[model samples]
Target chain A: MKLPADVVSKKNGKHTIQPLSDPKIEAKDLDFFYSEKKALSDVTITIPSNRVTGLIGPSGCGKSTFLRCLNRMNDIIPGTRVQGKILLDGQDIYAPDMDVVQLRCRVGMVFQKSNPFPKSIYDNVAYGLRVNGWKDRREIEAKVEQSLRHAAIWEEVKDRLKSSALDLSGGQQQRLCIARALAIQPEVLLMDEPASALDPIATARIEDLIQELKKDYTIVIVTHNMQQAARVSDFTAFFYLGQIIEFDRTEVIFTNPRQQRTEDYVTGRFG
Target chain B: MRLLPKSFKANKRERGIELFLLFCASVSILTTLGIVAVLLFETVDFFREVSIVSFFTDTEWTPLFAQKRFGIWPLLIGTILISGIAMLVALPAGLLSSLYLSEYAPDRVRRVVKPVLEILAGIPTVVYGYFALLFVTPLLQKFLPGLSGFNALSPGIVMGIMILPLVSSLSEDAMQAVPRSLREGAYALGSTNLQVSFRIVIPAAFSGITASFILAVSRAIGETMIVAIAAGQQPRLTANPLVPIETMTAYIVQVSMGDTPVGTLEYKTIFVVGMMLFLSTLVLNVLSQRLRARFREVYR
Candidate 1:
C-alpha cells in the first residue's frame, strides 16, 4: 500500500518504514455534539503507530471526548452526535459497515477512574477473552497471566488471583484494569487520565508501565498535567476550547512552539 | 459572667421537637415488644393443652372438629406450598421485568411503565382475594383440568402478582446501584449489551437481588386475604398445590372473624401460628440486611 505523503515522511529517498512515522489513526474535520451544543469542532489529528501521543487541556476542553471518539465510547451516551471521519488503519471507523464491537476490541480504553469489576482478579482480566468467545479454560488462564505480566502487576497479584479485584490498592486496581484491557490484545490503547486518581508513587508506576506498553501498542493518553505529557509522550496535541491548537513532537511543543497561544499556555500564562 | 447570646445557645423549641421525635421512635419499639409478649403468653397457654411433638409431627389438623387433631404440619405445609408456587410465578417475572426496566427501557418507556406495574401492588389484598376467586381460578381451571374451585394455585398466582411490584422495584434499585463505570468498562472490552447486563451488572448486583428475593418470600409468607378467600378453609398436609389448603395467616383471619371465647384453645392457636410466621420473617429480614451490608462493602 502506498502511504499518504503527509502521514509518512522519509529521512532520505530510500524506502524505509519506521512505526513511529506511520500513522495508525487519523481524524478529519471531526465535529462532535452533545444534543445541540458542540463539544469538539473541526478537529483533525493523526496518531502514529507504536508511539505514545499525549492530549493535554483543561477540564471540558474536549480532550477526553476526543479520546473516547477513537473507540466510539460516546455512542453510549444518549443524544450525543458525531459528524466526521475517524479512520483506524486507513479505514473510517464511523462508516456504516463498521462493527462497533470489533472496533472497540481493536481500540481498548482505560478511564480516568479505575473501574475493576466486583469479581476475582483472574476473572476480571479474563472477562474480555470470554466475551469474545474464548471457551478453553487453559487458554484463558494463560492469556490472563500474560496480560497481567505485560501490565507489570503479576508479582503483586499472582498469589491472590482468586481474590476480588476491588481488594487491591488503588494503583494495583488501575494496573488490573490495564491488564483487563490488554487481555483482549488491542492494537491501540486510549487512556483518559489513568493516573489522575493515584498518589505520586502509584502515578510513577503507571507512567513507567505506559512507556513499556508503547513498544507494542499505540497509546493515546489524555492528561491535565503537562509534566506527565513531557515525560511520557513522543507526540503531543494541545487542545483549547474543543480545538487542537498545536500538534508536534513533545520536545518542540514544550520548548519551541510556533503559535503564540501554544507558547503562552506552555509557559503557564493561562488555560 | 457575661450573658450568653441567643445564637450561641440551644433553642428550647428545638429541644422540644427532638423530644417529640424520640417519643415517636419509642412508639414503634413499644409496639414490637407488645407483640412479642402477646405471642409468648398465648403460646404458653396453647402448649399446656397440646404436646410440641404432636403439634409438629402429626400430619392431620382438625382442631374445630368433633375428633380434633392438633398437628401443625397441615398449616405449615399449606404455607410452604402456597409460598413455593408464588415464588415460582414471581421471581422470574419480577427479575426479568426489573432487568428490562433498569437496563434496557428507554427513559420515556420506563417513566410510563414503572408506575403502571407498581399499581398492581397498590391494590388492596382483599381485592386481590376476590380477583383470585372470580377471575384467576376460572382462568386457571381451563388449562389445569384437575384444579379445584378453591385451590392453592389460584391464590398463589394472585399473591405473586400482588407482590410483583415489590420485587421489581427493589431488584431494579439493586441493579441500578451497580455503577455506570462497570458497564462502561465492560463495553470498552467489546462486550455486547447482553454480555454487559448479564455477566458484569447482574453479578455485581447479586447480593441486592438476593435480598429482594428474600423480602418477597417473607411478604408471601405473611399474605392472608388471597389464600383465605381462594384457598378453602381445609388444612391438609399435602404437597400438591392443586388441592385446597389453609395457611397460617388464613387460620388467624378465620378465628378472628368468629366469636371464639377469649381464653379458648382455638384462640391460643392463632398466637402460636403468629409466632411461627414472625420468627421466620425475622430470620429472613436479618439475612437480607446482612447481604445488603456485604454488597455495600464491595463497592465501597
Candidate 2:
C-alpha cells in the first residue's frame, strides 16, 4: 500500500511493509487483581503507534480488564490492584509522580454503552475542553465543531447544539461520545466494544469511523465479534483466561494463526 | 375434562384482598381530605369575623390583645426568619456532607455513618425543643451577649441540625443514584473527582437534590416544638434573629395551649394560622414533585 504522508510522518516511516517501531504503549508482564481474584496474568503486548489494535476474547477473559489498565481506570474500583508495568510512550504510567488525570487526557476512552452526560449536546462536547481549561469560547466552538465533524456527526447535530444529548439516537450518541473523547485531542483512543449495543447499520458506521480515526489516533478496541476484529484491526491480540494467547497482524491471526488455541478460536471451534 | 377449574373461590379471595388494600389506601387519603375540609371551614369563619384585607395587609398580629390587630405579617415574617436561618445552616452543611457521603466515603464508612445520621432524625422533636432551650441557647449566649433566652436564632440553628439528616440523606440518595457510567464518562475525560462531582453528578442529580432542599425547607417551616419552646410566643414582625419571635406553628401551639375559649375569634386564630401553614407546605410539596418529575434524567 502507498502510505499517506501524514501516516508515514506520524510513525516515523514505520508504516506498512516494515516491522512496528516505537510502540505508543507497551505492557510488560502486567498482572491485575480485583481484591483476591486475579483478572489479568502476566499479560504483555505492544500497541504500535497509529494503528487499530483489537483485543479479542470471550467474556471475563480480561480483555476489557487489560484495556482499562492502560489508563489506570481500574483505580476507581475498590480493592483493585495492578502489578508490573504499563508504559505510555516510553514512560511508566503507574509511577508515583505520574498524574492519572494527565494520562487520561493523553488516552481517551469510549465505553461499550454510549454514556453521554445528561447535558446539552454542545455542553457534552465542551465538557472535556472546559475541564482541561480551554477558556476561549471561539476556540472551544471551533474545536467542538471540528471534533463532531471528525466523529462524523456534526451535520446531524449542528442545528440543535443546545438540545439535550440524551435526545440523540443510539448511533449518534455513540459518535457524540467519540467526539467528546476526541475534543481532548488524546493521542490514543480506547474503545470497549463501542458498537456492541448498536444495530447492524450503526455497527457498520462505527466500524467505518474506526478506520477513519486510526489515521490520526492510535486506536485500541475490544470486541467479541471475530469479523469485527478481522475487519477493523491492523494488529490483533487474542486473550483467553487472563493471558494473551496470540498477538500478530490481523490477517495472519484470522487466516493462519500459529497457536492451536488461536486457530480454534478463529475458526469458532472453541472460545 | 377441563385441565383447570374456573376457581371462583380464588377469584373472590383476590377481589376481597384488593378491596381491603384499596380501603387501606383510601383511609389515609380520606383523613388528609377531612383535615383540609375542617381547615377550610374554620378558616372561612375566621376570615368572616376578621376582614380578609386587614388580615393580610395589617402589620401587627395581636388577635389575643384588647386592641386586637389581625395582621398575619408578624407570624409570616417570624416563620420566614427562622426558616431562612435554618436553610442557611442546613443547605451548605447538608449538600457538602451529602457530597462526602456519596463521592468520597468508603463502603465501611458509609455503612457506619448512614444509620448514625438517621438516628438524628428519629430523635423526638420535643427532645430537640429542650435541647434548643436548655443547651443550644446557653451555648449561643456565650458568643452573643444580646441573645434572648427565648430567641429564634437558637431554635433556628437547632432546627437546622434536626433537618440536616433529612436533607443529607435524601440528597445523598439522589447523588448515589446518578449512574456509575456517567461518573466513568466524566472521569475518562480527565476530570478530577471534584469536577466530576460538581459538573456531572450534581447536574445529573439536580432535580432530586432540589426536591430534597424544598422538602427540608417545608419540614423546617412546619416545625412546631423547637420554635414553641425555645423561640418566644412574641409575634414580632422584625427580622432580627437574636430577639424572640413566634412562627406560625409556634403561634398555633400557643393558642391551642392557652385558656382561650373555643369558637371565639381569638381561638379561631389557630385555625387560620394552621390553614396558612398547610397551604405553604402543600405548595412546596407540589413544587418539589413537579421538579422531580420534570427534570429526572432516565438512563439505561
Candidate 3:
C-alpha cells in the first residue's frame, strides 16, 4: 500500500487534505491538447479505490476529456496529445514500458451513447473475454451471466441472449453496454454520461447500479446533472473551462461548497 | 367558397416542369429496356436455328468451323476459370489494402494514396490488355518457362490488377463508414489495433465488403478487351491457367469482329453470348444492391 510520491508530498503540505484510504488512480498536472487547442490544463486529482468519484461540469468543460484520459482513450484521435502522468495503482500508465492493451484491460469504460457491437447480447458481453484469449466455454458463459446480473439487466435479457443487441430498448442497450464492460473485470470503470440519453427512471436505475458497483470496483463518472452527482458519488470534482474548480466530499460539494462557482452550479444558477 | 385564387398558368408551368423531370429520369430506363429487348429478340432468333439442349450440352463451340458445333461449355468454363483466377488475386489484396487505408493510414497519407489508387480504375482497359500480352506474360514466363504467350493466367492477373481499385475503393468506403464509437468500445476493452480491426470493424462492415466483392467479380465476368487480346480466341473446356482460352465476352468479341455474314446463324451467336453475359451481370448487380441495402439499414 505504497502511496504515489505526489500524494505523499501533498499530505505533508499546509493544505488540510482528507486522507484517501486507498487511492487507485492519481493524475499529476495532466494537460491535454487536441492539436493546438488546449482542452485540459494542469489537472491534478486523486480518485479513491472502490468508491464512486463523480465529475460535474458544463458543456466543453473537459469532464468527458478527463474521463477518456483515465484510460488513454483519446490516443485514437489524431493530433491529440497528453502531458504529465496518470498513475493507475502506483504505476505510470503513460510510461514507455506500459502496454496500452494491458492498461485498457485494467481500466474499462462505458460511453455516453450505448454502442453495442452489431452482434448478439451474449456475443457482445463475451467479446472482451474472447479477445483476451478466454478459451473455456463454460467460464465465459458464467462470466457473461454474472456481468448481466450485476448490471441489473439479466432477467430482462437472459431469455434472449442470442438475439441481436440492437433490438433492445435504449435503456436496456445502455445496461447491456455496462454488462459488456463488467465482463472484462477491470479494476476501474469509467462512465461518460451513461444515463444522459436515458429517461428519468432509466437514469435512476443506473444511479442505483453505480451505488451497488462501488463495493468492488473504483468508479469514475462524468455527468451534467448535479443531482446525479450528489446521488451517486462519494467524492465530487467540479470543473469549468478545462480546470478543476473544487474537489470535495459529495455532500460538502452540494451543501457547503467553498467556491461561489460551485454553489452557483449546484443551486441551478449559471453553468 | 374559395379561400384563395388558383392560378391556372402557374399550375400548368409546374406540371410542365414535373413532366420534364420525369422524362429525364426515364431516359436511362428506356435505353436499358431497348437494349434488353434487342438482346432477347436476337437470342430468340439464334435459339430457333440451334437446338437449346445442344447449345448447353455440347462441349465444342466451333460455330464457324466446316462442321458447326454449338456447345457452350468451352466458353463458360473459360469464363469461370479466368474470373476465378482474377478473384483469387484481387480479393485478398484488395481487402488488405482497404483495411490499411481505413484503419491504419494517417489522414494526410490516405488523402493522397486513395486518389492515386483510384487512378488505376481510370486507366483504359485496352492498355491493360496490351500490358498483359507484352509485359506481364513475358515477366511470368521467366519463372514459368512453360507459360504460353496467350494464356489465361496473364490476362487474369492483369484483369485483377485493373479491377483492384474498384474493390479497394468501395471496401475502404464501407470500413470507413463504421462509427468511431464502435472502434473506441473495442479499444477500451483491451483490444489492440489489429484485434479491433479484425474482430469489430471487419464484422461491422461485412455486408459492404461482401457487396464490393460481388461487384468486382461481376466486373471481371463482363471484362472483354483484356481476355480478348491475351486469352486467345480458342474456346477449350479446361481448368489450366497456362493455356489459351476464350471467355464468353471474348467469344462475342471474336464473332462480332469476324467476317460472318449478317442474318446467318453463325453471326447471331454473338447476341446469344451477349444475352448470357448481360444476365450474369444483372443478377450480380441485384445481389450486391441487396447486400448494400442491408448494410445501410444496420448502420443507419
Candidate 4:
C-alpha cells in the first residue's frame, strides 16, 4: 500500500537522475546477434540506483535479451554474440577480467515463470546463501525471513517453510522467487515478464512489491503488459525491433510519447 | 447444416470405420489381457506341483539327469549376480556418456556421436555374445586366471554395453525435458555449471532418469542369448563372477533347446523359472513407475 520515496522523477520525455542518484549501471551501444539474426542493435541506456525501470515491447522485440545482457545470461545461449560496452558502477562489466559469478551475484534475476527449486521452501530460500558460504543457521534463517517479508510473502508461507515449494500457488511461488533473489542481497534485480503467468490480483501484488522494493534495490523488468509498466516502473524504455525507440519516465511514455511507434504501442494499436 | 446425401453417406461411413477400429483396438487389448491370464495360470499350475518353499529355499536346480536337485536359489542367485554386475558396469558409464552428449558435447560432435551410440543399441545380442566369448573372454583371461570359457563376467559386461544406449538415450530425453528456465535460475543465482547439472538438472529430471536406470536394469535382466552363449547354463550357487552361472532366462533357453524331455518336471521348470523372472521384473517395473510419478514435475 506504501510506495517507496526513491522513485525517479520525470521531465518532458526524459528522466534526469539526480547527482546523488548517479546511475548504478550504464549501457553504451550494446549490440547483440543470435547467429546471423540481429537481436539488439546500437542500444544505450542508464539505470539509476534504487529505482525500478521497465522495458516494454512487443514480441520478438529483444527486451528479454537486453535484460539477459545485464547479467550475461545470453552467454549460455548458443550462437549468441554481443558487441558493446556495459558498465556497472563506472567499471566496464564486459572487461576481460570480469568475473561472471560475482557479476551474477551483484545482479540477480527472476524469470517469467516462477522456478522455485524442487526443494522445501526453507531449502529454496537458503540455497543462494548456503552456496555463497553462509554457515550460520540463525543468520541464514533470519535473512530468509527478512527477504520473504520484503517480497510480501512472509505472511502466506511462514507456517510452511519446510513444505515443498512446488506446493505453493503460482503467485506465492513468484513472490518466493523474488524472496530468493533478495536473499542474495543483489544490488540490482532483472525480472523478465515476472508476472506474465499470474492472474490480475497476483500481478497487482507483484506491482506493489516492486514499488516497495525500489527503495533498496535497482530493478529492471521486461513486460508486454502496458498497464503493469505504468503502474510499477518509475522509468520505462520502449523497444521495437531490437532498438530502444523511446526512453523516458513511465508516465510520459504511457500518457504522451514523442515517437508515433511508442504512442501506438502504449495505446494498444499494435505491438 | 444441410444433410446432402453424398456428404451424409461419407459421414456415416466414417463413423462405421471408427467404430470398427475401436472394436479392433478392444480386441487387441483383450488379447494382451488373455496372454497375461494364460501366463499367470500356467505359472500357478507349475507352482502347485512344487511347493513355494522348495522353489525359493533349496540350493540345487538339476531338474533333469536323474539326480534332480530341484532348488531355485542357484538360478536366482545366478540371475541377480549377473544383473547386478551388468547394472554396476552400465549405470555410471551410460549416465556420464549421456551427460557428455547433452551438456558437454559440441553440436557437430553430438550430431556424430549420438547415432554411433544408437548403433550400439541396435547390435543384436547374439553378435554381442560371440564378441564377448571370442574376444572379451580372451581379453579377460590375461588378468583373471582359470576363468571359465563360459563365464558370467564377460557376458554381463557385454550386456551392460548393450544396454548403455537404453540408459543414455532415455536419460538424455529426461535431462533435455528440463526447461532452460530451471538451469538459468540456478546460473542466475551464481551456481557453477557443475552445480547446475549435479544439483538442479539431475534432480529436476530425477524421475525420468530413475525410470531410465530401472528400464536398463530390466533390459539387463531379460537378456537371454548373450548369457545363453557366452555364459554357460551351469546353475551354480556361488556368487563368484569367474565361474559359469546360469541366469533364469539362460536356464529357460537351455530347456527350450529340446534338451529337457516334454511333459517332465524338467520341462515344467522353465515355466516356473519364467514366472519368477516375470514376477520379479514386474515388481521392479512397478517400483520404477511409482518413483517416476513421485518425482514428477510440480513447478509447471
Residue B237, model 4: Cα distance from true site in angstroms: 0.6
Q: Locate the minimum summed-lDDT window of 10 residues in model 2 chain B.
A: B1-10
Q: Name the regions of candidate 3 deviating beyond 4 angstroms.
A: A1-18, B1-7
Candidate 3 per-residue lDDT over residues A4-64, each given as its tens digit: 2222112355645445668899999999999999999989998988888899988999999
lDDT of 2 by residue, A1-271 (tens): 1111222222565654654565899899999999999999998888889899999988899999999998888988889999999989899999999999999999999999999998999999999999999999999999999999999999999999999999999999999999999999999999999999999999999999999999899999999999999999988999999999888888888999888999999999987
In candidate 3, what are the lDDT values of residues B1-300, reduced to their tens digit? Answer: 343345666788899999999999999999999999999999999998899999999999999899999998999999989999899888998999999999999999999999999999999999999999999999999999989989999999999998888899999989989999999999999999999999999999999999999999999999999999999989998999999999999999888888989989888898898898999999999999999999988878
> Clash totals for all models, in order?
0, 0, 0, 1
How do the residues B83-194 of candidate 2 rate in per-residue lDDT, one tens digit apiece?
9999998989999989999999888898999899889999999999999999999999999999999998999999999999999998998898888999999999999999
lDDT of 4 by residue, B67-184 (tens): 7777888888888888888898889998998888877787888899999999998898899999999999999999998898989899989989999988899888788888888888
Q: Which residue pairs show backbone clashes in model 2?
A: none
Q: What TM-score would each prediction reach against the true structure?
A: 0.94, 0.95, 0.95, 0.90
Candidate scoring better on lDDT of 1 and 4: 1
Isolated chain A TM-score, each model: 0.93, 0.94, 0.93, 0.92
Alpha carbon deviation, residue B116, candidate 4 (Å): 2.1
Candidate 4 ranges beyond 4 A from true positions: A1-17, A251-257, A267-270, B1-49, B290-300
Where does candidate 1 stray beyond 4 Å? A1-21, B1-16
Worst 10 residues of 3 chain B by lDDT: B1-10
Give me the displacement of residue A8 in model 2, in angstroms. 13
User: Whole-model lDDT, candidate 2?
Assistant: 0.92
Worst 10 residues of 1 chain B by lDDT: B1-10
